[model samples]
Every structure is written in C-alpha cells, then in structure tokens.
Target: MRNNLISGLIFSFFLGMSWLTKADLYDATLAYQNEEFTLAFSKFSRLAQLGNADAMYNLGVMYLYGQGTEQSAANAFAWFSLAKEFGIAEAFQTAQLVLQQSNDQSGLKDFLKLQKSRLSNTYLLDSTLTKLKQHSTTPTLSKTHDVLPEYPDEAVRQGIEGWVWLEFDIDQSGKATNIEVIDSYPRHVFTASLLNAVEKWRYTGSKQAHTLIYHFATHKDEQYRETLAIQKKAYEKQLRQNIDAAERGVAQVQYYIANWLSMKEYNAYQLLRYHWRSDEPMNELYLAAAKNGLDLAQYRLATQLINAGAHQLGVLWLEHAAQTMDIAKYRLATVLLNTGEPQDVPHALQVLIEASNNGHLRATLLLVNTYLTRLSDKAQAKAWLRHGLIIDPEHPELLLLLARLAENQAEAKKLASQALKSASQRNWSSHAIHLFLQKLAN
Candidate 1:
C-alpha cells in the first residue's frame, strides 16, 4: 500500500510525459551534456512548446548563455518566468539573476506584462471552460475530511485576494488524487494552499473527478463589509486627528499615514478615500518619519529608494532599519550579496543569520543558497537548510535541496520521499525529484 501510494505520487509527475516527450527530453539533455548546443536547443524548444517545465528552464539557460541562440536576457526572463509558473522553483532565482546581470532591461518589463496576461486566471479559465463544456460532469460524493485552505502569508502581506479552480479525482479509498489547477485569479498565489488542502480531502465514493473553486478573501463576506462601513464612520474622527497630528510633525503619525497610504485600497478601507487621493504623497511622509529615526519608516523609505535606484542611500537607510527590522536585515543581506564584493559576503552572511534568528524564512533560504552556491560550504548550507526545515518542514524547495545534498542513497531517499510528499500535497510539478527517485530505484 505504501509502495502504491509512492508510485501514484511518482506517476502524477509524468502526466503529459509521453514516450516521445521522454525520449526528446533525454536526447536534449544528452546533447547539452555533450556540448551539442544547437541540437539541444532544437529539442528543448520542441518540448517547451509542449509545456515541458524542464525544457523551458533549459531553453532559458540556452538563451542566457548563448549556447545555441543569440544571448537574449528578455527571452531568458520570459522562459524562466514561465518555468517558474510551471513549478521550477530555481527558475525564479535564475530569472532574478538574469535581471541583475543583464546590461539592458529595455523590454523585460513589457515582456513580464505580456506573460502576466497570458498566465492570468481569467485568460486560462476562458480557454479551459471551453474545453470543459464539451466534457460530461461527474458528481462528487460526501466529503470526509475537507480541510479549509489557509491564506498564504505573502499574499496577506501584499493584500492580494484571489481564487483557485482545482480539478482532482477521488480514488476508491476516498482519497483525492490527480489534482490539477485549472485556473487561479492573480495566478499562483493561492494555488499551494488550495492544492495542499484538497490533497487531504476525502470523499465517500468509488472513483470520481471533481472540480472546485476556492476563494481567498482578506475580509469577511458582504455583510462584514457593511459592518466595516459603519466602523469606518465611527473611526472618522480618529482618522482626522491622526492626519492633523501627522501634519503637525508627529513622527509616529507621519509613519502611520505613510503606511496607510502605501497599503492597497482594500486594506485601507473606505476611510482613506475621504482624506487622501489615490496618488497620495506618501514618500515625503516616509522620509520625514525615517529622518526622525522611525525604524519602520526607515525600512519603507529604504525599499522605495532601492526601487528608485538610489542604492547608496537605500543601503544607508537599510543599515539603520536593520537594527530593528528583521525584513530590513534580510533585504540588506540580499543587496550585499548582489554587490559581489568579497567583504560584503561576510557582512551579508551575518545579517542573514540575524534575520534567520528572527524567524525570517527568506533569510534562512538565502543563507542556505549562499553557503552552497557562493561560499562552497555545504556543511554550513546543510545546517541552514535544517534550520529552515524547522520553520517549514513541508517546504518542497528546502526538502529537495537537502535531498540533493544527502550524503548517501538512504539519506537521499528519506529526504526525497519527504519532498515528494510535500510536493504532491501542493501539486507542484517535480519531475526532477521523480526522475532522481526512479534512477535510485533502478
């Protein structure tokens, strides 16, 4: 039964993996390994057209290094972005590297905009719904354990609201299987939660396919909104007083105003509409608060400066902010690492450790990546990876990385199985891990 479950998980990774597709990918990988760039490029391109994630990543690499095609950062970014969407976690970091290393970013923004539209839930849903109209529907039986999806922290922080449409089959044992994301609003944010929750869902039936849409809202229903409107009216006096204090040079009030201004409209509520326009001059408020030694405002101002290309100023602000903000320390560490200075590496590692100690997940991951990739310290990397696992045991990326660095086949298998379980629960495409396990089994 355990073997069957593992086999089922492995089989899911090969959904669109026809014999021809498998052969082509192997040929492409072999050609690349043999330095036959042109043939490798051709084969990868063919597979990429058929929506192969690994092929897309390889194609991005080819474009990045001018292996068989003209070196094109734009093309590399587009392909890497697509590969990331298809669940290649490293592709996102690669895409960021492309941007950081590129001489010209002229068309990259436009390309990303185009990709966003193409990958949008609305766009994908229209095409998928058309296909579904031709197919017959299957009824869902009683649900035994339907876990409600948790809202993603990043999405909540960004005030992002979206929905995911999922399709999955319920096996004879009342377990959901063969889960797929049909579409998702804002694309990808809510998907992990939906997939993880759905994978645990059980139904009392033989075998059946079911479709579901899960909505993620930061707030409650329409009735809650109506109640919120009344509450906003009650808070109007306090809002006016806060604005008055901000204008009267109260640093805390200034920071509060800036923070409120920077928030999304949904997060800000309707009261903000009564006082400030959409184009509120929040930067000045942030600057004022930052100058007054407000750590939060300093962090906000630092990010704004960094985005606007004031690197030196941003770094100075971040340095100040880092003393109080874990996220600031993380950002500062990333900047130091990107600077590529030998002295900066130690400083970056120090700040990353500080951020990690404060329970910042990205900082921990960056520390692991830095030790493994940049510093060539696998021991340190392993230690940091273990720390991150403590924070998120089910994190597929961390698990997969640890699996790759496993000292022996037994360790590798143990880590890989954990990774496979996590990835399966989240419905993440994990062909590389699947293939690795298959090789080990052989």
Candidate 2:
C-alpha cells in the first residue's frame, strides 16, 4: 500500500509539472511587457479564450493601453473582472483603476451588474482551474458549493428588470461573510437572490471587501455594446480629421483643436497628476493659436494661465481678447475683480456693464447681483434685466429675478410661478437660478 501511494504521488507531481508551462503564454507575456502590444494582444486573446488567467490579465492591460484593440475602458474592465474571478491576484486593482479612467461610475456599476448576472455559479471551467492551480499565491473562490439563483417569478410577472448593489467581506478563513445591500431600486425583490447566492460564495485569500452588482433583464445587452462601438468609431475618425486639420493649419481648426486639447488636459489632471506622463503640451498649441490672433484661443490661454497663478500674463491675454469678444470682456471683469483694490472694482464693473449691454445674460445677471449688493440700486438691476428680457422675455431665470424685485407678495408669487412653469416646460433651469429660487422660497 505504501509503495502504491508513493507511485501515485510521483505520477501527480509529473502531471502538475507538465500542466504548468505554456510557451505561447510566456511569449505573449514577454511581448506585452516589451511594448510589442499588437503581437502580445493576439496571443493573449487566444489564450484568454482558453481560460488562462494570466492571459486575461494581459489582455485587460492591452485594452487599457489601446495596444492591439481600440482603447476601451469597458473591455478592459470586463477582462479584468474575468481575470480576478479566475484567480489573477492583481486583476481586481487594475479593474478598479480602469473603471476610474472610464469616468462613468453609474454606467460602470450597471455594466458590472450585467456581467455578474451573466456569470453562472455552476459554470466552473476546467481551463480556469488549470491556470489557477499553477499559481498558489492567487486566491480561489470559496468552495462553498452553493446553487445559482433562477429567474424570479415576480420579475417576469411585472416586467421588472433592474440591478442591485451588494457589499460583502471575505473573512480570514477565505469565506465570504457579512453580505448586505448597498442600493437597489425596488429593493426587496432582488435581496433574496443576492443573499442566497452569497451564502455559498467563498474566497481563499487575505481578507477583502467587495461591492458587486446583480442585474436582471429579459434580453441580451447588445444594444449598449452596439451604441458604444458606433460612438468610439465616430470619435476616432473625427479625432484623426481634427488632428490633420490642426497640423495643416486649416483656418479655425488650430485654435479649436487647441482649446479641445486644453479641456482634455483639464479633465485628465486628477488621473494623470501623480504617475501618468504626457509629452503633449496643450500650452504650446494655445500659444501658437493666440499668436495668430484667435480670440477664443487667447481667452482659453488667459484662463489657463490665471488658473496656474500667472495673473499678469493672463490679464494681458484677457485684455487683448476682450477687444473683440464680448464673453472675453465678461471673463476679464471676473479676473479684474480679484485685484484687491477699489479702482479695480469700477473698471471690472464697467467691463461687465459693456458685456451685459452686448447681450451676455450671465454678465447681465452678475451685474444685477453686484449692483443690488454694492449700490443697492434697484433701477440698475431693472435696466440690466430689461436688456435680457428684450432678447428673451420668457427666460425663466430672468423671470425669477424679476419676481425677487416684485413690490407685493402676490406679484412675487405670480412671477415665481410663471418662471417655475416656464423652467419646467423648457428644461432650462440653471443651478445658480435654481439655488436662488430655493433660497427665496425659504
């Protein structure tokens, strides 16, 4: 019996050794790290479909970098989620980062819920187990041996299809514990489904907290995928055209593209500030465009400079742009207002008055607020508002301001009602006006 046991152990050891190595997977990983992304992507994708966790993780990275496929945050997220479940140790962290870069938390949550729903508890692939068995450091799903939930009868009866967010903790023993709901529309319906599934879900790793989504639906989620594909293709084509036009100096394209690049940089600041490096400087584009006397470019450059604390240079740009652009004059007034002197106030107010006279509603509103606060001048506020009313009488915000100036309570109420009704009908309620109306109501 002892000799037979020893022989069995030796056979298992040889089997494990044979199963562990894959020349194609190793080559793919090497290529990925060496920045031969296209070649790496092909190999990794092929292996990922074979249920290789490492290949799945690499595929996620490739998608994130736009190496072989179109740069798709959604695809990256999906691949990483698969990798994480299949026992890739670092895939979870990478997936979270990919989602953050996508800049759509609500949409991502929905996507994840749908993904979770599509995954079957009974669906353990032999290939995934083979890959996972080779990496002992990687965590395994807790072998709790639980059943996957069936489609709820109530869900079908009322045509109810939605998602629920669930939070759970993996304990020191690699068991999923303390499951609870975070958010769900029509809460009680999906709670049982989540709780029952989680009861048998386990993880074999260090303690970790996770929030997952479970979405219910009647049909395949092909519509959203199709829409995203169309948008991505359109954006890419437009981007290439814009880049060509900007480089060739095709009329207003230079300034327009420069301004767009500036906005992109601003949006990316938080994400790229710490570690992500970029050689593309939108400042050079802005400078070139401003030198060519692009009024919009000058204004944007001035705003950028002011934000970076270069006040004197920014003011010059603002002043130059303000010579032709009414909006620039309004923005110049805003910059001048921070100069900390009584003389600056008069000049700023004058610039604002000019902009307001030129049909800038925001400038007019700012003038109204300033006049009402500084000089307590009801006449000036009325005059400023009248200019906007001439342009657009049914402008809900201006109507709301007029209500604030009403002589009697009944007049105020009538004006307020008119503005609210108009705003509701038109979907044009600005946050500033909304807050002001709320305050006046209180």
**Which lDDT tens digits does candidate 2 get at residues 1-442?**
5335433433343233211223235466568669888888887775554345556666666676688789877777887778778665556766776676667867766776675555432123222222223333323245544556544665644444455656555544444543446455455887787677766665556342244556555332334334544455554555567555554444245544443443332222232222223344444455445544456656665655554555665676777678777767766876666566767878888888888778776567667877777668999887787887886787676788888888876787787777778765654434545565576678
Cα lDDT of model 1 overall?
Answer: 0.67
**Candidate 1 lDDT, 1-442, residue by residue in tens:** 5335433433353344322114336567779889999998997875564345667777777887789999877888888878777656666766776776666675785786786665453223213213323433434367887788887876655445556755555555566654545456667888888887876777787442255656676673344454555565545766788776665456666665655664454434355555655444465555555544567666655655565566675677788788877777877998998898999999999999998987777778889999999989999999999999898888776888898899899999999999889877765556667888998899
What's the residue-level lDDT of 230 in candidate 2?
A: 46
Clashing pairs in 1: none
lDDT of 2 at 146: 54
TM-score of each: 0.46, 0.39
